[model samples]
Target: AQSVTQPDIHITVSEGASLELRCNYSYGATPYLFWYVQSPGQGLQLLLKYFSGDTLVQGIKGFEAEFKRSQSSFNLRKPSVHWSDAAEYFCAVGVREGFKTIFGAGTRLFVKA
Candidate 1:
């Protein structure tokens, strides 16, 4: 069974502070990992993905993640977060099948001025 766990149910960051979101997973073999962000009423947007090759993966909207196989973790980071970055973020794992994807509960980001 594959699963994704986001330790923090929610995270709060200052408008210009650096941010990091944690994600851990349990999978049998090499798993396809991804990070998605959902703004207020919008659908999920692909923030980044790690399908192998490099441990460090970069995505849209000034986001990047590093995959640590030994730790079974893929954490997202941003050097400086903007207020517009506040939203729900989900970490997920999928097989080559593409249909069997498991997503974490999600971490809602709140940016404070």
Candidate 2:
């Protein structure tokens, strides 16, 4: 079965500091990669996704991700982070055929002043 792994259970970054959240996936074939953020009491919001084409993709709210097939990694990065960015991030993999998505354990981001 396909799976996603977020190595960091939680990460702390100062406001305005650069941020990078690691994500690795395991799948037999190329699958869709996604980065979703969920606030304390809100539903998950899609931050970015990589299906094909370009290796690097930009997302909303100053976020981006790079898909490296060789590394099986789809890491999310931001030049600067805000206190509002603090939330739970989940890395997910989806296969088009069955339309099923598998999410990682999730990484909680703490933005310190």
Candidate 3:
């Protein structure tokens, strides 16, 4: 079985500050990884993904992630965040079906100026 755990249920950060979110995964083999962002009452959008290759991958919205095989982790990072960046973030493991995906519970982010 494959699963993801986000230790922080919620986080709050000030505008123009650096941000980092923790993600841990449990899988029998190397699995596809992704990070998605969802605004309040909205659907999720893919931030980034790691399949096979470079450990570090970049994505939209000025975000990046590194796949660490040793730690079994893929953490998301943003050097400086904007107020609009405030939203719910989810780290997910890709499971193969015909064509589908599953997501974590999510971590709500609040931005205070």
Summed backbone clashes in each candidate are: 0, 0, 0
Considering TM-score, which of the candidate structures 1 and 3 is the better prediction for this target?
1
Residues 35-112, candidate 2, lDDT per residue (tens digit)? 999998989999998889999999999999999999999999999999999999999999766799999999999999
Q: Tell me the TM-score of each prediction against the true structure.
A: 0.95, 0.97, 0.93
Q: Which lDDT tens digits does candidate 1 get at residues 3-106?
A: 89999999999999999999999998998999999988989999999998989998999999999999999999999999999999999999656578899999
lDDT over C-alpha atoms for residue 62 of model 2: 92
Lowest lDDT 10-mer window, candidate 3? 95-104
User: lDDT values of the candidates?
Assistant: 0.95, 0.95, 0.90
Q: What is the lDDT of residue 1 in candidate 1?
A: 78
Q: Candidate 3: lDDT over CA atoms?
A: 0.90
Ten contiguous residues with the weakest lDDT in model 1:
94-103
TM-score for predicted model 3 compared with the true structure: 0.93
lDDT of 3 at 32: 94
> Which pairs in model 2 have colliding backbones?
none
C-alpha lDDT of residue 101 in model 2:
92
Output the TM-score of candidate 1.
Answer: 0.95
